[model samples]
Target: MDRIILHCDLNAFYASVECLYRPDVAHLPVAVGGDEQMRHGIVLAKNEKAKAFGIATGEPLWKAREKCPGLVILPPHSRRYLHFSQLARNIYQRYTNRIEPFGIDEAWLDITEKGMDMAAGRHVADDIRGAVQRELGVTVSVGVSFNKVFAKLGSDFKKPNGTTVIARPDVSRLVWPLPGERLLFVGRSAKNVLHKVGLFTIRDIAHASPRVLKGCLGKAGENLWRYANGLDDSPVAMVDETDPIKGLGNSITTARNLTRQEEIRFVFAHLAQSVSKRLRKQGLVGSTLQIYVRFSDLSHLEHQGQLPAPTQLEDDLTREAWRLFQGVRVQKPIRALGIRLTQLQSVEEAAQLSLLWNEKKRQQTAQLEQCLDQIHRRFGPESVRKAPGLDENLVSLVRSTGVASLPGRPHAF
Candidate 1:
């Protein structure tokens, strides 16, 4: 039996969610982004109207304005987006258990086990799109196909609220004519390389020799060849069998450059607490802490330190992250700071605490953070914060700059 897969992508997720809440700007060209005063002003997401004006995601907010002056900007509410993402997944649950999330706003569902054919898959896609629109006040573009690659391509073919299906034998006719960049994982650099070699279209990739593609781009080039040829057989990971998260991280672009240890400490406190909360929630601990610093000029640096033992305590994370930060020699003012914990192990897998660090204090801090987590879960994230995080200036910077990625947990809106 042939596989039936469907990829669903939320349309302008951030902008759409903003519109749902702010009806006044619902019809205008809207964007969801960071505060420019913080030097973090970038268009994270743009509405269809904004897209029509040639304003793309990741463009600086000032440039987006230059492109379209009337663009309505809304501050992102991370919590709300998380809520809606989960709600959308709940909707997907109605159709099949073989659902795999691509990101917060996209997922792939395999309905083949349900004994469905392409026609049935199309019906399921339409049903899901309608349900999402009616219930969540957002639309989804779905791609239905025999493989993951083509299904993802189909989803991107249409926009906002539409569905496209590509059958097994129809791939050459439907997908080949498109640009090579449209193929999954084909970024600008790869496209440029392919272009230099006269492989300008998907059809070019489909017809190219695997040896030449591999010789030029190595594994990546070879993988793209297979994807372009409709040979993707990667399975939709079962929810229960999904891989464990390798890291927990959070980064923010400060309103102003941080040059003082005190200023850096203030920011690290918030980031450490945030990362620790997620680690505790996931019942994991990390033995390595990494700090990423991006300068005002856009250049970046990273430093990593080993912990005496696996820990999820905010105090441990804050101390180690601060230590790592102190070790780095900054030649420029730092514009952003990131805290990441890798080399993760389940809390249950952790060994006894080493004598290098105070065991009693570790236990106490762990308990304290656990209690705070409960309070935050019951009330709101802002209900409890570390004492050092009380600086209003630092608080505003952290809030305005916004989070880079919230791995397992949905960040607070």
Candidate 2:
């Protein structure tokens, strides 16, 4: 029997939650934004009304204001979002213990064990949507399907509040005509590449030669082909199964566009420092390091490369991230810079060593980082400097964006 899966996504989550608490702005077009004074003032989330004004999430607040002059911008309230997220999770627990959270506002539920057939799954999706609406005062869009990938695609089929069911018979009719990007794991960058080859829709992706797709998209192209053909059979995680940390990253939006190499390095150093510390704390190391750059124009690009070896040392991370950034041809001043460590392995695993590099130097550096972590733990995070203190403006900028991770960036599962 085909397993039943449902992807539940909260509608305009942050903005909806804000409206619930701030009734004064409930009827107006509202958006949840960051601190303008801090220069992180981007539309983090917006309600349906704001959507009508062409106010998009991740666009600048000034631009959003230009689009909708009467737009009400409210600061984010994370605590409330979390409280409501947990409450919604509680509702899911009543249905099944096999719940896997895609993000705070999205989750996947495996209801096959409940003996639910495809028809029953749609009923449950409606029940979940209605229950969340009545109890939490927020709407949910749900996609019910046989597997995780299609379930996520189905949930995204409708918005604000709707339930979409995609069963085997519906694949050719409903799923194929959608854009290739809608098939999942296809970002803007990847979409352009596929488009270049005339693979515009999910049907095109499915019908295209696998070799041709892989030649264009590499491993991701192959995955897209499988997803387009309804070949995704990945299981939803059980509730008791803790999600493993797949990657670690940190980023900062500067108060000013960073043009100087020295200033950019300072930002990279701080971000890498935070990420490496977190990796060490979690007892993990990564072999791949990725750097993300958002230019002053809001245009962005990301590049990544394999490291010399798996590492959790700040110096190693900073050096590798800087190496990757240097290869990018700078067309514009940087508005934001980020570092990410992926292809991670637990520190408990034996690290590969090479005589090609000085292993002893790396050991010394790791020891030094551990000592610094001890000092930072006892005194404070500011007790030690990572990269021989650069500009004070950059120093405070990093401090202001303390514990910076990619805000609202979801992992493509």
Candidate 3:
């Protein structure tokens, strides 16, 4: 039996969410962005209206404005985006646990265990697409297929709100005519090599001999060939599954350039707490702490230090992160900051506290943060805030955007 998979993608995710909340930008060309004066002014995401004006994400806001004079740019809201991402995930859970997130706005669902066929997969996709629109006031495009790669391509086949299906028999008719570069994992260098190999379309690559592709592009070529011919068999990971990863991290591009140590501390407190929350949620702890600093001019440096012990406490992570920050004698005023923890171990096998640090204090901090976690889980994430996070602008900036990638957890909306 063939596997049934669907790739669901939220349409204009960041901008769409903003529109639902901010009535002021209704029917206007909108884009989410950072402070232009702070050198973080690129368009992070744009709505369909803005896209029609040739406004591209990651391009400077000034350039985008030139394309559309009436472009209404708004500051990014990180916490809100995370909230909506969670809401969408909640809806997806009703169908299957075999949901694998690609990013904030895209995920792949495997419903083979439900005994779904290609037709039923499309039905499921349409159901999800409708649920997201009616329930969340946001639209989604779904691509139904037998594998991840083709499903992803199918999602991109249409926009805003769409559903496209590419079954095994339809591969040549629906997918083969596209450019070879459009295939998953095919980047610039790979495209050039494929062109040199006289493979310009998915059909060209699909029909090419494995030896020819391997001789040209190595393992990547082989992978591309497999994807083109519908040979991709990667599983859609369970939503709640935690694979043993190298590390976990969170970072933020501040709303404004941080000039003083107090400003830096404010952001660090929020980040450490956020990272610790995720670590504890996954029942893991880290033995090494790393600090990342991006300066006003975008030049940056990173440094890592050993923790007193593997810890999932906010205070401990904050202490080590601050220590690492102090050790780096940077002359430039910072534009953004990040914290990461590595050399992790499951809480069950975590080692004893290092003698250099007070064991009683460590235990106390751990206990305190754990209580806060329960409070957060019960009330809401923002129910509690550190006193140091009182700086109004800094607090707003921290809440605006969080570049976080952590273990997935199961939860209800």
Query: Among these predicted structures, which one has the highest TM-score?
Result: 2
lDDT values of the candidates? 0.86, 0.86, 0.84
lDDT of 1 by residue, 160-270 (tens): 799999998789799999999998878767899999999999999989999999988999889999999989999986755667777889988887888878888888888
Which segments of candidate 2 are over 4 A away from where they belong? Answer: 113-115, 346-348, 351-367, 374-379, 383-390, 407-413
For candidate 1, the 10 contiguous residues with the lowest summed lDDT are: 404-413
Number of clashes recorded per candidate = 3, 0, 1
Candidate 2 structure quality by residue, lDDT tens digits, 137-225: 99999999998889999998789899999999999899998888887778888899999999899999999999998898889888888
Collision count of model 3:
1
- Alpha carbon lDDT of residue 118, candidate 2? 89
For model 3, how does the per-residue alpha-carbon lDDT over 265-284 read when each residue is reduced to its tens digit? 87888888888889988988
Q: Is 2 or 3 the stronger prediction by lDDT? A: 2
Which scores higher on TM-score, 1 or 2? 2
Q: For model 2, what is the error of residue 310's alpha carbon versus the real structure, in angstroms, after optimal superposition?
A: 2.9
| C-alpha lDDT (0 to 100) for residue 273 of candidate 3 | 84
